[model samples]
Target: MDQVKTYRTNVRIGNWNEDLRLEEDAKNEYLEKKQRGELAAQKVEVLKQNMLRPVDLTASSDGRLHFGDVVMLVNMGGENRARSTVSINADINSLNKTPSPAIQAPCGISAGQCVDACTRTAFIITSIDGSPEGSTLHFEQSFALRTTSGFAMGLYLSSDLQSFQKCSKKSRLQEVNLDDKCSFLTWWKILHFDPQERLEYEGQPVPANEDVVIIHCKTNHALAALGDQVLWTTYGKEYEVTAHTFLDSHKAEKDTNHWMLCTAENRLELLNQSQSTADNQEPTEANPGI
Candidate 1:
């Protein structure tokens, strides 16, 4: 036999009072307390995402990015400070008719409502197959990059999950674990330019200071920096970064698809091609190197 259980919610609804009763005041106070609690939780989450996490550099001095290194994705397309490195752009718009930059470009009148789009952000590189440390990052295997706050970078998807983003394949950071199925968005692969060169170097470890195109593991679109589609961000005028592919039956963009995994200790500038020693790029944090 199935047991049926019923509870009482509005038992005193028959009583109507013109003046504010004691019970009404108590209920209103309780609602206010609950709302405060919810707001506190939201603020905590904001801090976790916006706060600058303390991450240490793990890239070695071997002139290659390893499997488990905390490196910065430096766009080699431009030399301006705004186009220096890729960072989070999860700024929410205010009630002043400002547009949201959660997964798009930032647009607003007041600078205070915007978040920093270039804050020297770093990401932890991990292998999808439990590859050991000190192992060079290769293209054949899948990889994931995560921030210290646990936000995994993934491709943007519509709420209905039936339609894909048009023209611009945008990406956003979603808090998820690597084992989660949704983590597929965080997985990506790298490939060197030049088909002949790539084929010749297939399965070979990719060098850190070389020009490479990063491809999304789930959508096959490549991460590209649009020099012509530059947008004004909170930081400044930055080259528009997007995951472009299959545009008007054409292939992905090439000129802006080059990126380099630069270490804070050893900055690798594309224009300058400065390969400094690892002694200066070594991080002071406690995270040991591979």
Candidate 2:
């Protein structure tokens, strides 16, 4: 039996008026050349949905998973144009299941061109001691950040998976309301959003705590945070964070845990953080420290 196969590609046709604004004969020649390219491209299928452009992927506490972004093309110097999170069933092979749209943030640009183009760089799940339902999945959009921009923007998928809300109250696409001193990446690290380990809170295996992200940006500054609270910020021109790893030091030590960060210069810097939640010295009726 002879088999029929289809090949696919993605391309942007050049603007006729702009590219052919020369003499009539030159314009005609240019169009003829472009037409040949277009005809050749039609021989193969042009994949329209960018399912491989996701910057991050994470599973929920219940084992349901989601991935970020569906771009048309990720070109050079392109910013994140991802806009939604497509939720997947726990059993990936389940038949006839459609991707449920859970998180959506319209960029408010050209309609239908890129309806959901907000780029998401990272995703993390956090269950603070006092948060609603004890946990929520966070999606980060870092493409909108600048060197000195205020606020990293993101969307929050509620624990129940029923709604999506903006993490920043001033939820504009171009600029979100985040801390002035932090970019989206720094805050992402500060939140300890990745390399999640299975943890036991009240005697069950769940994703919890580990909310300390150390961000070493291009500015040669290292910043650490414990769930949004800045622990320390230090500057060293020679230090540019290249990677982070968990060092299992002080296995018997409960108060402080150690982590290692690799720098551009190939030096490892160890960071220690206290996990103890008790403070007896500054006990007050209305305020308790953790």
TM-score of each: 0.54, 0.19
Residue pairs with clashing backbones, model 2: 7-44, 7-45, 8-45, 9-45, 9-46, 81-117, 82-117, 82-118, 151-178, 189-213
Tell how far residue 251 is off in model 1, in angstroms.
Answer: 8.2
lDDT of 1 by residue, 1-290 (tens): 88776656754445456335877898898788667543444544443444344455554687777877777676644433223555543433311111321222121110111112222256667777778976888865678765443332322211111144323322331111122232566578887765457777778887775677777776666665555544564434654455654232244345456666766454433323432323345665684544
Q: For each predicted model, how many residue pairs clash, with residues at least 3 apart or on different chains?
A: 1, 10
Off by over 4 Å in 2: 1-24, 36-57, 61-214, 217-290
Q: Candidate 1: which stretches are off by over 4 Å? A: 1-55, 78-82, 92-120, 150-182, 230-236, 245-253, 268-290
Q: Cα RMSDs of all predictions? A: 15.7, 23.9
The 10-residue segment of model 2 with minimum total lDDT is: 266-275
Candidate 2 global TM-score:
0.19
lDDT of 2 by residue, 1-290 (tens): 88766543544356856664667778788688567533323312111111112332222344321122111111111122211111111111111112331222221111011112223222232222233432333322112121110111243211111113532112211112122232333332222323242131222222222222322232212221112111111110111111222233432211111121111111101111111222224767777544
